[model samples]
Target: MCPPNCLHAVCEKATRRGLLKSGFTLGIAAMAGAGSLAGGARPASAATDTGPLSFSKITDMSHTLYEGFPTFSGERWFEMERPVTWEKDRVNLNRWTLMEHTGTHIDAPLHFSEDGNSVDLIPVADLLCPLAIIDIRAKAAADADAYLTPDDIAAWEAQHGEIPEGACVAMNSGWAAHLKTEKYTGLDAEGKNHTPGFHHEAARFLIEERSVRGIAVDTLSLDRGLASGEFPVHYDWLGSGRWGVECIASMDEIAPSGAYVFVGAPKVAGGSGGPSRIVALH
Candidate 1:
């Protein structure tokens, strides 16, 4: 007989393997496409006449998942058990029990809209796009309930050129610095989560005015924590058939612009969303 929750264990392994395979395939396809456009077959290591597409640095933007990672409900949402021990079974295997939205995760449109796309249904092309980091660290340092407003976006564009269409606009609130701490959630005396996120107007601007593929944040939700259970950003953005990433890490390493992001969202069939491995290249 199989152990309890064995299906979840299998699914976890499959998800990891699938992500790796997909990345590998995509990389090869991109290289081949570049070579084809160059008018001749070129070795994978050879640079194109216009110069090879390369990154000077790669930064991981996904936070490590652990049993104690904070969740929206203020409860422990991840657990792990070593079902196969190295000393006893000559191998190491763990069974993880986690909520789809735990840790650093993607929020599919279906998370808010019934007729929206699920994680697996999101277009592969949308997962890879330019990254635009909107720095709100100073504001958030003063007010934990600070959020990305349309004015902030305008200011960012004024300095760093207009945000590229189909880019992922991320909020660098410096919240990742408070990970695994009580300050991360900033629970008030009344049990309200005081974290930085996207303002409703900002969400509307990105969705209606800009052609962004999605939004990301270094916090727990797309809406400011003080929204008092009113997730306007979440509903507005996701309802428009776009996705969002939350709990991102290492925002400090990525520049405000001139970087591309790869969102390694899981391919879980019918899943509303799942923990994702997000990386940035610059």
Candidate 2:
């Protein structure tokens, strides 16, 4: 069920008190135990033996994929079975199969545009960039179909300064907290799925005006759930040679801006989309 003052969807106003009082902020510390996806590789300052490079906390923004996690209806869900066990084969081995876009994943340009680059073609440098988060969860809680508009982007900018060119933008709906509920997929009485996403104008503004490198969301698709068959967000971003990340988890842990994210996904030949392991450093 939705929280008090939130109807079938979430509420439009979220206060720090409300977020804490509702227990939405609990257990989040568990997501921040790791640091530095770059691993043992240190910056040049430390390489010179002057001193150790300053370290930052790492927060994993990817969801753990497992057998039978919720998937878009009609799409293949993940499945795994143990092929070998310690008692039988002297080792533990398991095999799993899933669609490319399943769970936390990236949608390469080829996923939507015929002329766009495939997963293997996306440059390594483009996958990592400045992170800017646009929080519209409060508004989305009031209307499941709500999307970010130009004004919304401006509002975020007013507080965080301009969203830099080539930066990665994240649309944090606070919906990840609802992943265990039916509200994650948001099926209404009439069987329509209503969820938050990027409005067409907002998408265009981000891509054409702001020159953003990519966008991520906490929902199933960058387009709203009720977009029916039209994927405006995908067409706008991927069509323009930009990439997108979907089903990103734990975005609420990061600040609205000034963070860096690394999008690491297997490079599948001729693939349109693939599973990704995304992380943020703050």
lDDT of 2 by residue, 131-195 (tens): 89999988998988888788989999999898865568889988788777888888767677888
lDDT of each: 0.80, 0.74
With a 3 Å backbone cut-off (N, CA, C), the pairs that clash in candidate 1 are none
Specify the highest-TM-score model's number. Answer: 1
Cα-based lDDT at residue 7, candidate 2:
36
Candidate 2 lDDT score at position 259: 75
Q: Which stretches of candidate 2 lie over 4 Å from their true place?
A: 1-55, 74-76
TM-score of candidate 2 on Cα atoms, chains taken together: 0.79
The residue pairs that clash in candidate 2, if any, are: 10-141, 12-138
